[model samples]
Target: MNAISDTGAAGFLARFAAMQGRLPGDSTLRLAAANAFRSLGLPGATRGRRVEAWKYTSLQALGGMSFRAGAATAPAAKGIVFVDGRFQSGTEKNFARFADRADFGELSWPDRDPMAALNTMLAEDGAIFQIPAGIDAGLVHLTHIGTDGASAHPRQTIRLGAGARMTLIETMSGSGCYLHNPVTEAHVADGALLTHIRIQADAPAAFHLATLYVAVAAGGTYDGFTLNTGARLTRTEIHASLNGPGAVAHLNGAQLLSGSQHADFTSVARHAAPKGTSRQTVKNVLAGQSRGVFQGRIEVARGAQGTDGYQMNRALLLSPDAEIDTKPELEIFADDVKCSHGATIGELDAEQIFYLRSRGIPDSEARAMLVRAFLAEALDPVTNDTARELLEDAVARWWEGQAA
Candidate 1:
């Protein structure tokens, strides 16, 4: 390592030193990432420096603990499966392993992000997806499972050629206490389309930190949605760049949190070219002592004339102890852009519940109905029947827990 590290970071660096030779990538890149991690350390780990990007959340629980690799198991899945952090099995074509191929991709900035640097130094395996031009891959599934006490880092790449179309359904779930850190990069060529739906259902005692970077070219689209309902601590960060004229990007999601759970959804959308559009809407339902955070930022470059961007974040609190924090920002250098952002935080309307009760509905059922109605708008873009069903089922289970 190039510099001193904190205790928690020292533990990870020690593991990297013990296992660097075994990691299946170019040693130089991994070493550089290690040095980066050594210098950056974990956010809020020691309070030496503050990272505004991580102002609303902390990795205290993950940094102080030690985790081992999880056992891999073979489960029947249509597309691909990752056990722990390795590519255990897959039934899909046009795919490869990151460990076997060593494809780090071009979109991520490990030097700038601590978690990305950590993943870069320790990732053992991942998946590579490629869709050929003019081909329509209707649907595919990606699953991640981490058994007890595991620390897994998986790095993946996704590419869609011109005029290609694909829908990706991602499911993340595990058992016991573990940490799942995955970084993904996606490139959409001209006229390509990619639809992504992520369902994160980790164990209640687990930690999940995920980051995604996407670049969309002219006439291309990247439509994505996330549903987060599990984990003791979770943060999902996304960066989407509209690099060419007429490009479109949508980052939408919802968080259903209860108990002492903490979840953060942060996103940045940049319009780098003229005539680009970006949209985001995130909803949160908090119960018990849960806490939810949303941070959304939009940037319009000086040359990005005719840019259109909009974002809205809303939160519903079921109990007095529940809390929500929201920050919506727009940084535009273009005069010809139409950009706007807003946030709303409140509890369920008592009059609305009363109206529903007058129609012969129970109070719990009435509140549930209103919550579902609020989430329906955020889920409207998920048109795939299978993906929507998965999200619906997860939401239902979370609701059941709150009711109980």
Candidate 2:
């Protein structure tokens, strides 16, 4: 805890003070988070010091903008929806509003992460879903809609009983110049399986900052994927902990950035027990003056022998001005663990484009086809049909905008 910026911290704390009475959950926890937020402030926004976690991204602009808690309206949909973090539509058997039951869960560390602290301090509403033992929840749709000039902090919680299975699809889409900060905590019990797919397509001028924490027990599997192609500045951070033997985790994602957009995907996978396995594969495609970032780390505990972990980051620069940053780290205390990490950064192959062009295809179409081929291999891991179609449509729209 060090000195932080008054301009950013003061305004944020002030908002909390005004709404302290109306907010739910235990007041003691929220107050503690508020104290931490005041101490940490916005990373790189203050002039005093900087932290390594936020080395590639800055919250200076977000700290300066004063967003409102204005009302929002979302288009009618068949799935559950939240407008500015408040419940709006749809229903499920085991679903409830965060505003109704605001338990912050036991996984997050607001005292260490400033963004998590902010969300803990001021989160108003979110989705809370649960699954019974041995039951299979086929598919769950959760969507968030934002409005202009407003800010929303939503806290989501999902828990699965032993032998249960679930597939969750989440989307964030809106039209605004607002800010959306959400924190999610997921619990996977022994012999359970959870697949989480996220698509973030916020308004062009909006800002998005999200954090997710997951815990997997013995014989459990946590499969996660994210597609980001919207917002002016976005950062999605994930932390996964394997707490029992034979637990598995798969963290895979793709980022398509264009114009002056900036997106960062940071993740940490920790194996605390023996025979745990984790794998991560990330792909980035950038055009114009866009910038993309990927930072991933794998940690194996002292007794966590026989751990198998591997991660790879690859980026394709579509324009000379496009930029990408990659950082991969592996920390192991056990001698029998097998872990490896690597990164590749390059532009598209001109020969491939020319080969297709010589076959009488237009230059733009040929280039698009090659790019699709590049993304095809990465999207293979996603087995859900609806999720696959959603990713394809999002990629197509992004490419169309870039070509225009």
Candidate 3:
């Protein structure tokens, strides 16, 4: 550990002192969570670069930023909004339709992630809902915003009853060099279905860390996608468990990064029951010395027979200094299972660019077209119309800027 992370308890204690009484959640729980974070200390850039999990990411810039509480703002139109760590007004109208299906709980994962613990310790408010069986909860939108150098921790819990269905869209926007940490837990009961889409478009100097944990019961399905186009540093971590037979989980995402930005997407899919299925597809577009990281792991339990797992990651580097790192791992203990994973890194195909250019398209436009096509393959799995449209629009806007 370097001096930055090795600050031990002093660093955490100082931060806790600055925003101690203002934190959300039960006091006892928050205290325990803070202690947990203090125990692990922070991850420093000098030492973090050597750690297996932090090999490609650095935290030195994070330590240099001084983060305070964010200001509370009113809800945006037609969605639940969280400003800083407080929920905005007017969300009561959607309580019956979307806001009442989740409840807060201690979301403890197998790994002791400091970011999650810190979020739990400081979060003042979060969304919780429990959708009843046979209900179509319609589309629910949640927006999180940060201002200036402020920091915010937003948490959420969602439970879908049997035969229920819901589509959720989460958007993050902010300015300056703020730190935003969000944690989410979702449970899909038997025969239930859920579609979740997250878009991160924070300021060019912001830091974002998001963690999601999901459990799917028998005959249930979970579809999730994340779009990362902003932020100086970001890490999106997802953990999914197929707890019952015939459960399905689909995770797909795209990262469009430029400048000196860095984005990392890590996920783990566990097949605990027989005949479960999991799929992961990720694409990255990097330019201007930007970096992208993808780490995906699929594990089949001892009796998880008839399991099917697939993972694919592709990267397009637009600059000589741009970099992409991908690792796909599979561990199967079952006798009957089909699993495969692949990763590819390259620039735009010269043949495709040539073909488009020969057809009257400008070189820049041809490159943008190729980039759009590359991301489209990863986004094709999203079936929700509204969510898909929103993501497509974001991708289109990013591409337009790139071409310009």
TM-score of each: 0.96, 0.96, 0.91
lDDT of 1 by residue, 1-404 (tens): 22324246777788788788988878899999999988888887745588899998988877678776545674656568998988887767778888888788888888988889999999999988888998888888999988886788999989999989988999998888889999999899998999989999999999899999999999899999999998999999999999999999999999999899999999999999999999899999999999999999999999999999999999999889999999999999999999989999989999999999999999989999999888777688788899998888888887787778
TM-score, candidate 2, is 0.96
Clashing pairs in 1: none
Looking at model 3, how many pairs of residues clash?
7
| Global local distance difference test of model 2 | 0.89
Off by over 4 Å in 3: 1-12, 17-26, 45-51, 92-106
Error of model 3, residue 218, in angstroms: 0.8
- How would you encode candidate 2's per-residue C-alpha lDDT over 286-314 as one tens digit per residue? 98899999999999999999999999999
How does candidate 3 score on lDDT?
0.79
Candidate 2: worst 10 consecutive residues by lDDT?
1-10
What C-alpha lDDT values do all the predictions have? 0.89, 0.89, 0.79
Cα-based RMSD of candidate 2: 3.1
- Residue 282's lDDT within candidate 2 is 92
